[model samples]
Target chain A: MSDREVGGAAEAAAAVIPGSRAMLAVIARSLSPLHGQVTVPQFRILVILADSNVALRSGDLAKALDVHPSTLVRMADRLVARGLIRRSENSASRRETLIELEPAGLDVVRTVTRRRQRDLRRILERMTSGERAAFVDAMQSFTRAAAADADADLTSFGL
Target chain B: MSDREVGGAAEAAAAVIPGSRAMLAVIARSLSPLHGQVTVPQFRILVILADSNVALRSGDLAKALDVHPSTLVRMADRLVARGLIRRSENSASRRETLIELEPAGLDVVRTVTRRRQRDLRRILERMTSGERAAFVDAMQSFTRAAAADADADLTSFGL
Candidate 1:
């Protein structure tokens, strides 16, 4: 491809991430209270555990969130300190740790989830049903484009 | 309101923020180098300046971003270091400083805009023209909804 074509492809490939970042700032601002009570990394770990059907390894969690394994380890340590999650060695892979939400973790997730659901519904109520559907569809499309733009690589980040 | 009614209302009101946050994470990841180079707050400052018709005071920027005036001041310090933006004393208000993007800041915003437009076009290319229109409309709706939801008194944060 020509240099201009390459730049076009690169831009096409990376555009949604910043757009989503703009959206996330609003989301983060709305949910800032949670950070006053719980750190973002810790909250993310809780959400992963709460939403999972079974316990997952740190590597798996890291991969899913597209965070470095070291970052996940630090977050897991904080969660354990807060009694929101428990981590134990995986017998099959001693180096790997399996993590699950504890009772407190579940409670935290429940509270956060409830609050989040309320906020989402309120936003939706403001929009016509058609708008809501369109929003969700655009989100899905943006995500799909992003995933492709990332070259579908997640194993290294464990995402 | 009844206890249950209040709980339900709170939940409905809180949901959109997190969902939008998750979507933003995906978007930010997709955009890559733009964020890799600048912190989100710094980028926000740049965006606001880019969108502004005239230089803005720290208070106006703080209010626009739902951040503390001190936070904007600190961010402005960093931006000045990067030479991306500059601050000038407001003649009308001795205590107020007007923030404006420097040439570097303008260039950065311009590149980001071009990249985003290309990205949107590429993503839209995957769908019919009607779908693209719907997608932009959805994003605008989402922005409005989040902005309205955010209008709820954040005065506690001194915002």
Candidate 2:
């Protein structure tokens, strides 16, 4: 897996790229049961709201989600239909309508999170202590480094 | 960050949980530019097709994507309209529609991947050699272990 000629980034990418897909697969499986209940995009929106602990302006949410305003409107429309989220009355006239997660929306986040935690725990337990400790240390280091990077992506509904 | 009382899974989860969000943020940032060009859900479908390298049966694709049949059809409907993918004529009456990625669809996956690689490389390069090595080893180890786990998620469009 080491490409001496393509040192640094390319080699590093080659070494760890497979892990990205594996990690995503882990998350996706957690979302499987709720497939019909909520689309992936909707779930992301719910996560951001849950993390923020407050209603978000539609425009701000759209920007954070990296969707066009119209697209957010459309996605929000579906959420409204499903009653996972709703538009809060906005007293601030200059700002866009504020959207808030409903109790139902919180359930989706909780369900998937609980599932992922269980799966991750199972996998972690199977690893030798060296592998498990390395896994955790590397993950934490990467997160810390990436979060500090100005270029770190803001798109995942600000997840 | 260590929770002594919550050993094993709970402890491991604590160490790596933050990284999960950071890693997702990295991916979400890569997908940011494609926000309007392709909705996140739609992009996911295209990625599945691109990776598969052949027309996928609508039913199988739906199952692999972990989406309801009706939802896949709806998502595919937009993709078809946008010319990112198309329905291939299927001779077998028993099979559902076959979806093939168009040139346009390939382009989208390529763009995001290129961006993500560039971003990841930059991040990897900034790390100490030890950190980078741990990342590669841990990532590969985790991918291998998770892939082997019978309970590992299959909901991420077979990615």
Per-prediction count of colliding residue pairs? Answer: 21, 0
Model 1, CA-based lDDT: 0.63
Q: Write the per-residue lDDT of candidate 2 for residues A1-159, one digit (tens) a residue.
A: 456523866678756666877776676666776867887878888988888889999988887777799999999999999988999778867556999999988888888877778778877877877888889989988886786686523524323
User: Could you estimate the TM-score for every candidate?
Assistant: 0.68, 0.75
| Candidate 1 displacement at residue A135 in angstroms | 5.5
Best-matching candidate per TM-score: 2
lDDT for each residue of candidate 1 in B1-159, tens digit (9 for 90 to 100): 456555543443443343453344444443464655667668777877776657998898888777888988898898899899998998998988899999998777666656555654555455544555555666677657756666543311110
> Which lDDT tens digits does candidate 2 get at residues B1-159?
355423766678766766877776666667767967898879988888888799998888788766799999999999999999999878877466899999999999888887777777877877887888889989988887786785522524422
| Candidate 2 off by > 4 Å | A1-6, A32-42, A53-63, A66-108, A151-159, B1-6, B68-78, B90-97, B151-159
Q: What is the TM-score of chain A alone in each candidate?
A: 0.59, 0.84
Candidate 1: regions farther than 4 A off: A1-26, A60-69, A128-159, B1-26, B66-68, B137-159
